[model samples]
Target: MAARIILNPTAGNGKAQKLFELIQAHLPNDVEVVRTTGPGHATELARQVADQEDLTVVSLGGDGTHHEVINGLMPEGKTIFAVLPAGTGNDFVRTLGYPKSPRAMLDVALYGAERRIDVGRVNDEYFLTVSGVGFDAEVAGWVNQHEKKGNGTWIFLRGILRHLVHFQAEQMTIHVDGAFRSEPTFLLAAGNSPYYAGGMKICPEADPGDGLFHVVWVKDLSRLGVLPLLTRVFRGTHVQHPQVKTFQTEQLTVEGPPNMLVHADGEIVGHLPVTMTVIPAAIRVRTGRS
Candidate 1:
């Protein structure tokens, strides 16, 4: 089968270009390489290639680019997506146990086994990893708007601190599997994969193939309350905290104050009052041996 690689050279502080070159060096000599020129170009390229050619389509960029690529290839198509993880967070790639190095990642892309994984749906939108609303979405919005123009964990730190100072909790009513939670919350995340925000394992026990999605809700916290738990989240241990609640469901609906911020896989999608569900094994993923 033909293999097509869509490269976004601007990803990961422009290091995606170097990764693209390395991927080129290791790919089978017959594979075709296409460079994306600007935002959303990678998705367009991926969809076009998937529709017109019987080939494996690879996305070589960060989570946003990967997000776009998945949107381009959903709902029972023959095209298979493999990620090269050449972006800042590469969170979903990490979830699949792929190495960070370009050569190592390409080795899997070249030889990895194929597996079926779940993809999430909000209204009709697709999210391979997660969809978040409330406080974290505010953080994501701030990060995208004011992020330091460099590559490092500290940049995210600064962004979070900035958002924390001004972020406000919202009254939300969450309905999961017929259970209701009416509370003031800092954040609510529904995940198909286990992590978001770089590599923070927001739902540590999540399994994409389980035919269920996981949700994490952070209750209203004081600055003091949220701080100690922040480290726990990065360590994938925040679920142990009392103010944090985790649950699983096949479907959920969230209604919040009007004009609430919404994010899916780190990109702001729209305002709140959304319905989300898990579509069991809805997509075919190129994964390594289990």
Candidate 2:
């Protein structure tokens, strides 16, 4: 078997390209490296290679790249997937217990345990980490428009602070499994992994292989009240707060303000009125610990 590496040169502010060049000599000779040109290009490249039975398709970028690759390989689950973190906010790799060193990550990609993990689908899009609507989605929109400088955490913090000042909690109707709740929601996160928004631990108990999603919703909090909850998110203690609610389910639907944005794995997908479902053991991935 051989490896097909789909690299996004623009990810991590061009750091991905540099890392690949630095480690090119160390990679296996049978590997084929391909660089992505623009947004959604990784998906196209992945789709082109998904039918190969004796090949492993690896993504050498961040969460967005992984999300794209997963979407492209979906509905056809024959291709094996692997990831080497080379982008800012590599949240999906974090959930998989990936090492920080590029060499170690690459080693795992070449020889690691294969595990089947669940995938979350929002409308028709697939996400390996987390997806949400409202406040965090607004922050994602802000981060998308602004030029990022320095660390990803700092950039996201700046975006959150800037948007919080003018952000309004949207009225949303949420249905989980069969239960229903209609309220003013600040943020609704359905997570298949434990981390998002640069290691925030928004859904600390999420397990990608569990075949269920950890759903969290924040409601009835004033703007100032949200600050303390945001702090708890870093420690993953926000779920204990009174205004926050957490549950697990296989599916859910969210209806909110028409203009409210929705984000999947940190990339803005579309507006609200979205339905998310879980596909058990949807994709096979090479991980640090099978």
Candidate 3:
């Protein structure tokens, strides 16, 4: 079979072109490279290829690029998904144990196994990672509104501090797996993958293909109490903290302030009072983790 590499040239500070060069050096002759110009272009390209070409589709940027390519390929079962990790905050690729180094990630794609994975949906949007409404989603809106430069955990750290100072908790009513919670919460995250925001393990127990989503909601924590828990999210021990509540469900409906921000996989997707549902094992993806 052939391979098609769909790249977003603007992803990861324009490092995708360099990654394409490296992949060209290491890839087989049958693989072809295609670059996307803007939002939704990758999905359209992948869909056209899926309709006409017999090829494996590889996502060659960050999670946003992967999400777009998946949107392209989701309607048909014609392609397998692979990751090249060339974008900022490659949380999904890391979840699959692929190294961010171009050569190593390429080797994993060329040699690793594939598995059926789950994808969640919020209204009409698709999310391969976590979806949220509340404090974190508000922060996502800020992240999209401003320009972020440089890398490392500090970028998200700065955003967190900025939001924490000015952000207020919302009163939400959540129905999950036949249980109900109505409270004032600072954050509510429903996770498919274990990681978010570069590498915060918000739901360490979450299994992407297990047919259920993990939800973690923090209710009424003081800023002082919130800081250390947020810090511990990287290690995934925040779930064990006193102020956090962890639950699992197949379908969840969250209603609150109609104007609260909503995010799926780190992008500001919609406003709150949204519904989320898990499509279990709905997509086939290339992975070595499972």
Candidate 4:
């Protein structure tokens, strides 16, 4: 019946640690808080408690931290999960309707309704939001390597612009639920829930509880077409573009051009030849939505 919070202290430039300290005064004594020492620590913490029935495991960082936590608790687990958005881009929480205030979010994390949601598995890791390869994956690498500050969307936009100027599209073959298409590729995002790289609705129609992935595929784009097309991603209107393709599938694979970087939930995990699979109602999470 107790709750354990696995928090990434360095997330948002020490913002998560500060928020955790402040919220301690308001949390019930049964709630235990554990600060992550480094990368992958949250996953280890989460795994230790994943099998504890009736327990709530709360993720108190951004998408990266949430990614680690969910990977630890999934495949099989009984612990209910919750999130307290504290990183530069809390993209996954956007789909959950979590409150913005730390105190209010704490309330929902501890006392909200529990709902089952789909999880996207890319290779071995699990992503709660969007996962992709090609140009966007390169953008994610650029954003992660440099210093991150302020609103994450602006930072990502800057990365996108910087990479777009010199980036070359790769040849890729994407297979969605058995159908295949091969061509010069811009980027393909497989989304379990909408909202990635802060607030860009890369796959606008994604629904976490629907047991499917809304995949968005962008065809090769000329340098001139990049600006106009990318600007609409925030509004998710880019899908209407003639070169863009969107579909729903339970599984898919991307092959071609080895060493092509792949990212899941904004973290660069591995290279190409990746398979994305959706696990229906894979994890239980606390949500504020009625």
Write model 4 residue lDDT over 208-289, tens digit each, in one string.
9999999998989999999999889899999999999999999999997888899999999999899999999988899999
- Rank by TM-score (best first): 4, 2, 1, 3
Q: After superposition, how far is residue 262 of candidate 1 from its true place, in Å?
A: 0.9
Q: Tens digits of per-residue lDDT for model 1 on 1-290?
A: 47888888888877678888766656787688888887778767777766643477788888888888877777544577788886666778866777657787887775677777888888767787889898778877876665437453555666778778777888999987668879999998998999887878887877888998888989999977777888887787898888889888989999998689888878787887899889887766677656
Error of 4 at 63 (Å): 0.6
User: What overall lDDT, based on C-alpha atoms, would model 4 receive against the true structure?
Assistant: 0.89
- For candidate 2, the per-residue lDDT at 278 reads 92
The local distance difference test score of each candidate is 0.79, 0.87, 0.80, 0.89
Model 3, span 1-290: residue lDDT tens: 47788988778777777788776878888888888988889888888776533467888887778878877876564577787876666778766877757777887776677788888889878878899988888866666554247453566676788988878887999987677879998899999989877788987888888999999988888888878889899999999887789988888999999899899878887887888988888766767665
The best candidate in terms of lDDT: 4
* Reference-based lDDT, residue 109, model 2: 82
How should the candidates be ordered by lDDT, best one leading?
4, 2, 3, 1
Show where candidate 2 strays beyond 4 Å: none
In Å, residue 223's CA in model 1 sits off its true spot by 1.2
